[model samples]
Target chain A: MLQIMEGSHAVAEAVKLSRPQVVSAYPITPQTHIVERLAEIVADGELDADYICVESEFSALSSCLGASAAGSRVYSATTSQGLAFMAEVVFNVAGMRLPIVMTIANRSLGAPLSIWNDQQDSLFLRDSGWMQLYAEDAQEAMDLHFIAYKAAENHEVLLPAFVCFDGFILTHTFEPVDIPKQEEIDAYLPAFNPYQRLDAKDPISFGMYATPDYYQEFRYEINAAMTRAKKVLREAGAEFGEMFGRDYSGLVEEYRLDDADTAIVAMGSVCGTIKDAVDEMRDDGKKVGLLKLRSFRPFPYEDVRTALAGVSNVAVLEKNINIGSRMLGAVGLEVKDAVYKNGTPVYSYVGGLGGRDIRRKDVKMITEWAETGRNDCFFGLREEVL
Target chain B: MGIFLRELRIHGRGGQGSVTAAELIATAAFKSKIYSQAFPAFGVERRGAPVQAFVRFDDKKVRLRSQIYEPDYIIVQDSTLIGDVNVFGGMKKGGIAIINTEKEIEGVPDGVKLVKIDATSIALEILGLPIENTTLMGAFAAATGEIEIHALEESLRERFPGSLGDKNVAAAKKAYEIVKGGL
Candidate 1:
């Protein structure tokens, strides 16, 4: 069904159809609407789920953990400060392999107390062993949640997943979204079959303290499951595309990259503008394409390398920065690492920080700078210094 | 084509309905069989923060992906954003610029037609608040004649519900009359 929906509302709708058995929430900026809608759905009997109003973000994830451990499909959402508050619980959720799906409306964590968009909140938790998927638009935000649930629950990849969408950019923007029918979603996703459930009949010990001898293996298993998840993500995305006609490749997506000497790399909403820039620049006979990073974790290193094999220059536009080290660098460092040994030149750019609007022309300028194969800092500096 | 493929830039304060006004115009246009798109440029500006939104409407399937760098028309709900952020930047030649301030705009860019209306006064009188979004849009229609006042009212009915819808329609109608009288 086609509907004019807010980004967070669309995400909530997708979560509803995914049929999470437990919906736990703590109100936070940018992510409030999603929980608000989910609460309404549960309240109105539109959805048959336990909508738990938790005391804090910590409890929100903890409640989800408790539900998932008891073999219930779980869903939750949080933003910058909320995610920070729940950081310890986030690792525990992943460590327990509970397969909880969370939507982190990306925002800047701050001492100055900003409620705007920034990737700092989520990026900081990238190493927590959860599969991270970044959504480019409202429609993608809606669709990826299903993908997250499917991928996370796969027995080979019994892990949690985080779908990050820009705060207020997609969350607040009103977009025309093609909501998939419930039957189609059902066809794509099967019922949750948790690998291990905490039933009294089975009586399996969970979250038990492990000594140094076994602790390493448990950590190793988490690492291995993440690698397996990369393949699972691709398969689930392919299956989803076959069913609903929307393609989501983990790591990266190429837009008009054929025979192009220059490639502009970005993630999330900036890709929308970059595609427009690429189309116009191609018409003007500039050989430019775009690479959109979708899956941030398990950082599709090989795919990133393969996509940019022929291009002489690649410009990476990072919304969040790894300040103090390389300028305009992503904390993951996988994009840079992709070309490190392969011998390709990739320029990094940090633009549109703190909710600054990134325009098409700015993307075009970044493309131009990369095409010249010249390197200098281009931060899309918002103010002019006298 | 009811969708005008229009790119309108609206200027107002945070609580003044600049974004909402842009949405209403797009909604009204879409109701008239136009494919409409609307987006607001939001910051941390609180209740009285300067804000803006861009709207596009077209009869055909709109594929142009660029933000409205060169708006075909401009609406100023607060009028104060005009000086703060070059509100007239990249306005098309012969484009309509509508402002809600009582003072006349002088030294505007050449080849641009300007229309000034006291929409804030009208909104304060009618809605008892200075949310000049519908009123400014009404002034927008009257000055540009891009849309009929009746079409806007019909759009309000489609976009809003109950007495709130009726108030918005009345505000839009009154705004149109102000523009019609002033112009």
Candidate 2:
């Protein structure tokens, strides 16, 4: 049944349905409501999961890591500074090959001290070997969790995943979402069956010191598993679609991209405004379209290439800035790498930093900038662009 | 996605249910099988500080995440916000505004309709507190017809169970009847 609820609550409901054996998290703004709701679920006996109260994000993920190693499905969530604090454990969780799932309520890192929406914090951990899934709305955000656990826990792809949604934009927004019955979710995603565990009978150390002779191969094996995750997610997502009806078959969801002159590529909730803008631009005979990235860490290189192949030019609109070099933001850099062989000019426009709004008109203007092959296009501040 | 889209903006001071009003209204619309979304400005709100929240009812899933700039309707829960904040700003002509006040307001733009109701008095009488979002929600239903009175009542009851829900439903119904009778 469709119920109107906050995005955080939807995620909590999804986590509950997934029936994680353990949940350890420290609360931060935007990410607070999610962990808070999960706490309520656990405390009220609605869910049987053990809720560990940790002092900081580091301890949160550390204990989740420990729980996963003990053959228990674990979950956690954090954002911004909290995520930054968990940086060491994040890589360790991936390196140990624990298939823990976490929610990232994407927020801006602070020296400027902002509790606002941005992709900076999550993107900072881009190289950490975790699958990052970006959500476009509350429904997508909640749905991604189900897929994340399914994909992450796959034995062929024992990798952790980040189900990321824009901080306040999705986390705090109220919208209608359908939460499946627990039994139905159980039917779709069965109980976690570990490939390996911390069995005292068969003792083996995890993340033990690997000498120079063996350390490099662990990295290679992790790479192989990460590569395998791409297929794993497609299979898991297709299975989810078969059960839920909303297909996540594609890594990138195309909107009016066929025969388009320019494509506006984006992630997270801003893509919604881009679609609204693209619709208007289409009415005005502008061949503008949107390529919404659903998964960012596996990078969706092939899917992005196929989607943007025919477009005359491409514009990557992102919330995080790539400092030092203007090659692009993290997303733009990866996208340009994917489609550059097609000889299509890809321009990067970074805006919406620290919760700055990306409006529909700004999307239209970015499309115009891309069509003209403009460089260093700063959105929401057209004066800089001019 | 559905083609019909309507936007509503709510203006009130902090701790006054501006966000609650937006959410309840959206919930009411969604229960009516209309796609609905509601969000508040990301602000560190303190009591009595002006704040804004918005709602959209669309035929298709509402995807736009930006703040509503051109609202089809508006609800001002505090009359003091009329000039302090541009409560009327960016409201489309032919739009309706439900302002909670007793004083006659003038200079409403041409093609715009303004309905001034003393929602605070109504809320105080029924709810025994000065919280007016439930009362304004009823007025919004009667004024815009975006949601039915029954839908709003159900959302109110679901959100506030037991006697609190009953009092809120009573406040909403009284306000709804008053607005419907006025029209």
Candidate 3:
């Protein structure tokens, strides 16, 4: 049944359906609702799980790692500063190959202390060896949780995953979502079966110190598993599409890209706005399109290239800026590298920082600017403020 | 009746239930078989500070995740917020403005339909509190015809169960009658 619910509640519902044995997360804006709802569900006996109220984000993820290693399916959520706090444990979880699914309500890192939306936090951890999947809306965010757990717990791909949704934009927004039934979700995503876990009878060592001789090979295996996860993600997405009506067939979803001369590539909630702008631009006879980059990590390089192969000019609209670098935005830098050999001029436009509104007009203007060969620059920058 | 999409912006203080109003309206729309959404501008302001919430209704799912830049209707839960914020900003031409004011409002832009109701008084009489969110939602349904009063009543009952739901539904009904009579 379709019910009107907040994005956070939808994610909580999905997580409950996934039947995670242990959920540990500290409260943070946007992400707080998700954990709070989970806590309530656990307290009310709706979801049979341990809701650990950890002191800090670091402990939240660390506890999840410990639980996952102990052969329990675990989950956690965090945002900007919280994620930054958990950075060390974040890489450790993936290095240990624990299949913990975390929901990253993407928010901007603070120095100015902003509790607003941005992709800075998760993108900062792009090299953390976790499979990163960005959600475009509440439905996708909810669906990605199921898909993330399924892909993460796969015996061949025993890697953690981050299901990222824009803070406040997708997290706070209420929408009519068709929450999948428990049996159906069970049919799609089987019970957690860890490839390697700590058990009293087996008594296997986990996360043992790696010396110089074995460290490089361990890292190589992680990279190899990440490379294998690309196919796992595609298959999980296809299976999810088969179970649910939403099709996430490709790692990068193309919208109106065919027969277009120019296109905009974006991730998370902004893709929804870009799609709207693309529709309006098409109405005005502008041959524009959108490529919603769903999977950011395992970087989907080949799929991105194929999606943008036909377009002459591509505008990369991202929320996170790579400060202290010539490469403007994190996603933009990756897109430029992905299509550089194709000779398609990929212009980077960073906007929607600190919850700044990226309206339809801004998307249209950015696309037009890219058409004129305008390279890397921030969109909607207040000239006077500078 | 031929409307494909309708957007509404609600203006109120932090404790005035503006966000609840947006959710209730969206719920009512959904109850009426219209795809709808509701959300508040995620701000860190405290009670009595000005805040805004938005709702969207369409024949199909609402995919636009951006804030409602231009709304077909504006619901002002607190009349005093008119001077503090541009309550009418980005309102579409010939749109409807449903306000909870005891006195006649001034400086409303021309070509926009206005509906005024003493929702605070209605809430005081019915809910025993100055929560005008549901009251204005009632006026909105009666004035704009975007949602049915019955649907709003059902949403109220669902949101506030038992006696509280009964009182809110009564307040909503009275406010609906007041707006209907005024028009």
Ranking the candidates on DockQ from highest down gives 2, 3, 1
lDDT of 1 by residue, B56-158 (tens): 7666544343357788898877765666888899988978888778887865788898888887788788878777788887888788765667778876777
The list of candidate 2 runs beyond 4 A from truth reads A382-386, B1-3
Model with the higher lDDT, candidate 1 or 2: 2
lDDT of candidate 2 over A318-362, digit per residue (tens): 889888776758888989999989988888898999998888888
Ranking by TM-score: 3, 2, 1
Candidate 2 recovers a fraction of native contacts equal to 0.82
Best by lDDT: 2
Q: Give me the runs in candidate 1 sitting further than 4 Å from their true place.
A: A249-251, A324-328, A375-378, A382-386, B1-6, B29-36, B57-69, B80-85, B101-103, B117-130, B139-155, B173-183
- Give one digit per residue, the lDDT tens place, for model 3 in A171-220: 88888888999999889987798887889998998889999989999899
Write down the DockQ of candidate 2. Answer: 0.74
lDDT of 1 at B148: 65
* DockQ (CA atoms), all models: 0.32, 0.74, 0.61
Per-residue lDDT of model 1, residues A1-386, tens digit only: 66555678889899989999999989988889899999999999988999998799999999899999999999999999999999999998888888999999988888778887878788888799998898888888899999999999999999999999988877876656779988889888888998999999979877888898899898999999999888999999988888888877555798888798988887777777787678788889889998888998868888888888888888888778776766466732667688787677778777677776677788888887777876646466846751
